[model samples]
Target: MTTEITIELDINGRSETLTLDPRVTLLDALREHLGLTGTKKGCDQGQCGACTVHVDGARVLSCLTLAAQAAGRPVTTIEGLSAPGGELHPVQAAFLEHDAFQCGYCTPGQIMSAVACIREGHAGSDEEIREYMAGNLCRCGAYPHIVAAVRQAAEMAS
Candidate 1:
């Protein structure tokens, strides 16, 4: 028999309760259980940053973080990044203005990581931005534009 445990989580600024298999990943819990599909399942491994989310304000790989391990921490997915009433986060706006994505498969992760990168003080230069954002791989090869977006957002935040 499968065992399930109930846990309460603060997600996207709201309180959430879930009864789930202990083995379920935070990524699966967010996407499969909570129906927040913005955090993609790109490689299903930690190798890809596509599953990135903010756990207590730090970027984390949801796929690699067990749901139980995230209990009681406030989690923020891409859907939660925007201000209430549908205003875009500055990073999101910068991405749009910079044309940072092509097919956009890696966009949510890129934006999430970019926000953290800037907040972490890693967006100081183009090289630094590249190094900091190295984990998020864009198949469309939009590195230049992505860097521009991050820089723009960083400047805007300053």
Candidate 2:
């Protein structure tokens, strides 16, 4: 037996209506239903920030966010972070320039979180950026570069 519900999400500046099982997390709905695979599934328990996404301009763990909980809210994934014409967000450009990722599995989430960290004014210093971004783990030990990327993006955004 299964129960399903419909939800309307404004993802990445696009509006999408999805019918999903109640148990379907926002991550599954985005990756499975919408084919937005940039948001990785890591430590599905929400301990890892791999599934980070912005819900109404605030960062959230998609793995633990229920699809229904996101209904009628603007959801922004890694795919939605840039302009339509492939214009990289400042954070994205900084990440690329700094080579903040090694394995790359955690890049999307890290980028997403980095954007939020700057927006939330938590990236004012290296230690602040590190603390705010601690949730997003890089298995390849790229923390230094990640911090540098956030710092660079923050400086550029100012």
Candidate 3:
């Protein structure tokens, strides 16, 4: 018999408790158990940035992290990126304004990573932004737009 563990994840500014299989990845817990499908399942192997999310305000690949590992930690999904009243986060606004996404499958993770890249002070230069955001691969070749949006967002935040 598989042992199920109860984990309380603070997601999107709210506490959501669930009794889940210990082997379930945080990505599955967020998308399957909690219905927070904004974080895509592109690779499911952590190679693609489609499953990225913010854990404790840092970018994390949910596909590689177990649900139990996220217990008691604050998790933020794309849905949480906006203000409660529906105001977009600076990165989100910039992404939209600059059309940073094509095909739209990788937008969530790209945006999440962009936010962290800027917060970590790596958005100072285009080269730095590319270096920091290298982990998030955009198959649609939207790197130019992505970099532009990230740079714009970083500037707006300063």
Candidate 4:
């Protein structure tokens, strides 16, 4: 027998109701069920921040978050970072300008975490940004460009 739970997700200023398996992780529900593939799945064990998303304005690893726990909470993924029609968020634009990523596998998580880092007043310096973003690992070793991008985004945001 299959058991399903109804969840209301306030995603990107929109409310969506979905019936999902209680065992489903928020990452799987977003990617597989909701088709929000922008939130990548790397190291599904939560060691990697590839599945990062904003829950109630705070960055959380979606891979470790249960879908049921996110009900009625605001969940923002990369797809919701910018306005519709592909307007890049300032951080995203800065990342592009700085060439902050290579394979882009971890870019989504990096950007998500960066946004939160800046919002939480943790982007005051490169060292601070690096320390705050330490959870999101980029295998490309693009820390320099990533730091540059975050700094630029912080300037733009301010």
The residue pairs that clash in candidate 2, if any, are: none
Candidate 2 CA-lDDT value:
0.93
* Candidate 2 error regions (>4 Å): none
The lDDT, on a scale of 0 to 1, for candidate 3 is: 0.93
lDDT for each residue of candidate 4 in 35-129, tens digit (9 for 90 to 100) = 99999999999898999999999999999999899998889999999868889899999999999999999999999999999999999899999
Worst 10 residues of 3 by lDDT: 42-51
Determine the C-alpha RMSD for candidate 1 after optimal superposition of all C-alphas.
0.7
Q: In terms of lDDT, which candidate is stronger, 1 or 3?
A: 1
TM-score versus the correct structure, for each prediction: 0.98, 0.98, 0.97, 0.96
Question: Model 2, 66-140: lDDT tens per residue?
Answer: 988998889999998888899999999999999999899999999999999999999999999999999999989
**With candidate 2 superimposed using the best TM-score fit, by how many Å does residue 17's alpha carbon deviate from the native?**
1.4
Flag clash pairs in model 4.
none
Which candidate number maximizes lDDT?
Answer: 1
TM-score of model 4 vs. true structure: 0.96
List model 1 lDDT by residue over 45-93, tens digit each: 8987998999989999999999999999999999999999899999999
Per residue, candidate 3 scores C-alpha lDDT tens digits across 1-53 of: 99888889899889998998899999999999999999999878878898899
lDDT of each: 0.94, 0.93, 0.93, 0.93
Those runs of model 4 whose alpha carbons end farther than 4 Å from true positions after fitting are none
Q: In angstroms, give how far residue 51 of model 1 lies from its true place.
A: 0.8
Task: For each candidate in turn, give its C-alpha RMSD to the true structure in angstroms.
Answer: 0.7, 0.7, 0.8, 1.1
lDDT of residue 78 for candidate 2: 94
